[model samples]
Target: EFLENYFLGIFTCEAILKIIALGFLLQPGAYLRNVWNLLDFTVVITGYITVFAQTGTGIDLRTLRAVRVLRPLKLVSGIPSLQVVLKSLIKAMAPLLQIGLLVLFGIVVLAIVGLEFY
Candidate 1:
């Protein structure tokens, strides 16, 4: 399944475009370099449109259980600032976890000591 998706989407498109891009690359050079990138954009847009156009020829909201998750993750790829913020949040959460564990251990130790005195 992974191989099928890879060949269909990226690898196949890249292989074919590399052949065409070769001509432009050798002559007009990197200024005309953006053609390959545009081909990539075209392939991706066509793929997504084709997926939704399948079956009933329109996107079925009932079958899109994962759209909400997909939308945010896809958008996050374009946001370096958001990625940095998320990284900071994960790091900040580490001390909270350690403090929670230590507080829990302290409560257990105190409970044991109080019980001994009683």
Candidate 2:
């Protein structure tokens, strides 16, 4: 199992590297930023197929929960779309976060006043 998994990893890495080399060498798809996301999707789908193939119609909800826990991996795996999305969300929410903190303080103050008055 270890050897098979190791070889599969090497094969996938080599294939992805070849495609990236070709992209650079041929200057293809320069406009798209999430080009590498396709590779991540391919790898993840391949993993799911392998697991299902080995187990034969028996995947529990707990197993699925663990799998879904990796949902953020779609963003964290250096895929450009996810990276840019997280960046944009942070940028957009910075001021909102600050405002939320102020709101929280106001709520705390109001709660204290109500407690003291009542």
Predicted model with the maximum TM-score: 2
Question: What lDDT does each candidate get?
Answer: 0.56, 0.60
Q: Per-residue lDDT of 28-103 in model 1, one digit per residue for the tens?
A: 5531365434444444555455455554576655443343234343334346887688668979998999999999
Off by over 4 Å in 2: 1-87
Model 2 lDDT, full chain set: 0.60
Q: Please tell me which predicted candidate would have the highest lDDT against the true structure.
A: 2
What tens digits encode model 2's per-residue C-alpha lDDT throughout 34-112?
A: 4455545455556556656667865443543354344455446556677787778879898999999999999999999
Model 1 worst lDDT run, 10 consecutive residues: 65-74
**TM-score quality measure for candidate 1:** 0.35
Please state the error at residue 25 of candidate 1 in Å.
21
